[model samples]
Target: MRADRLVSLVLLLRQHGRLSATALSRELEVSTRTVLRDIEALSAAGVPVYAERGRHGGFALLPGFQSELTGLNHDEALALLVAGSRRGAQAFGLGSALASAMRKVVDALPESHRATAAGAVQRLLIDPETDLLARRTDTEEVPDTVVTEVRRAVFAGHKLRIHYAAADQAPKWRTVDPIGLVTVRGQGYLLATRSGSDRTYRLSRILAAKQLAEPAQRPDRVDLDRAWQERSTRFRTGGDQVTVLARVNPSRRGDLVGTALAVRAEEEADADGWLRMELTFQDSRHAEWALWQLATNAEVVAPQWLRTSLRDRAAALATCYGVSS
Candidate 1:
């Protein structure tokens, strides 16, 4: 761990030119005294580290001293390049660090593989802005300050006070014990607890956030995957769950499954090649919303109310389009 810290200290100085012991301590999550001792150790090992004493003075390395720590193979360099292409780091407030690390990785690569690996990275794309249908996927915008504070609270094991606005609701302040942060499909969420009950808040919905000084009321260690899975199970089982029986065109099977919460059962295909299936949704509105997207490709078979709702909507749509039944 100390070795890693020393390497990081060198890299920090190399990147920023100069940084104070206080800044180093904060960045490294250590202490000022530790930073001083590490600086001395680096100098003793002929690292050319020097310190300046003044109001604006800090530690710096000799001019043009670059470390030769580039030991990445061709495949390793390409892998790092591909990983850097993802926008996940931006959601985690590590965009700048990822970019910096990518730059250093490329610079450290051997001359022969540098250009080739970079050129290969351009040929691959991850999470394109628009899909094949020309419809763009919306990305949630999160304030840097909000993400930073929430992240600090999660790592430091402190309670977080946030002003969050849920859908169609007024924003209000709430104190939550942050367990972890999760990002799905470019949208970030803070998985926390309030009054020992699970709560999930969208990061973009946070209007303001403050990291409280009091220690968070949570376990010392948490298994994020298990917690997330449990939350998902509760969510899937809890809401106003409704099951809809429908017959859908085979070509539109992917679309239906993607929008529905779960597929309850599948029946044999009809003479016309339409597949019958029972699908679960959150509520009537959810079932209506999803079926509406399928248009004529799917038909609701059971739960007469849902069929009537879809028919009414279709009738209204036809009326607006001036089509006579």
Candidate 2:
């Protein structure tokens, strides 16, 4: 609305005095012509706006003028409220601060925005305690000492040394330049660079950590989201991939696909009502493990070795149970 834009223009000038027409255009995301028109409108409305000339000069409001109208719009307020509802902030030790800020923001919003945003907040939930199956979910645990040291390096731009425990390996010390922290699905990760190469470590696998006094060698600015996305792509594509052709019960198809690294192809239900799926997993071990989870609900139809492996495992299990047909 022009009305809202006009109000925003006035507020922007009030907050940051002496802004050029071009600066106002950038701030308001409008063209300079629109800004000039807004300025004329404000002046005709008896606002105390005045223009100054020269290289460093721009528009400024009279010192004594002040406006009372201000508040976030419905979408903006709801976005902040929804973000605050997430549990990810707790890992960064901002739980109490986030709660406090959320209250203040809700209080400051216009009455309509407040009510609508509050209602929207209750309608959406992130990282709930239990999933659809009613099973409890728990986040990966990192020791306080490990979290604090890593957090310090990330915020202070310092190098960090940590005792990291990789899968099936003894803990080893490594020095890395701390970039930022990211949490997804309740698991925390430290995104960093080692010898100018990208590295990501699971926070729970950090046995110990120390913030080094030396400054970190990294770019002055970073887009953490882009960096995390790149790392995720690398992880998804770098593994020893094994594609599996399987037939699974229609109802349990989702369970089987969820364990795969990627689903290359899927077909409609066959005569028996079983769906045909072409799935890719990290490796043979991964493929074998994923299909095993569904038990009789899924069957491997290709990679003859996989069928034999499953048959042998079934035989061993039956023998161990001392069952005979």
Q: Who wins the TM-score comparison? A: 1
Predictions in order: lDDT: 0.84, 0.81
lDDT of 2 at 1: 59
lDDT of 1 by residue, 102-163 (tens): 65666667758977987998898888989999998777888888988998899899999999
Candidate 1, poorest ten consecutive residues by summed lDDT: 70-79
Tens-place lDDT digits, model 2, residues 1-325: 5876777777666656789999988867679999999999999999999999999999999995766645555433433543643556655544433443455455557656866897898898877889999987667767766887898799889999999999999999999999999888777899999999999999989999999999999999999999999998888888788888999999998888788988899999999999999998888898888988998998999999999998898889989899655
Q: Which stretches of candidate 2 lie over 4 Å from their true place?
A: 1-85, 96-126, 316-325
Give per-model CA RMSD.
Answer: 9.6, 15.8
**Which one is best on lDDT?**
1
Candidate 2's TM-score: 0.63
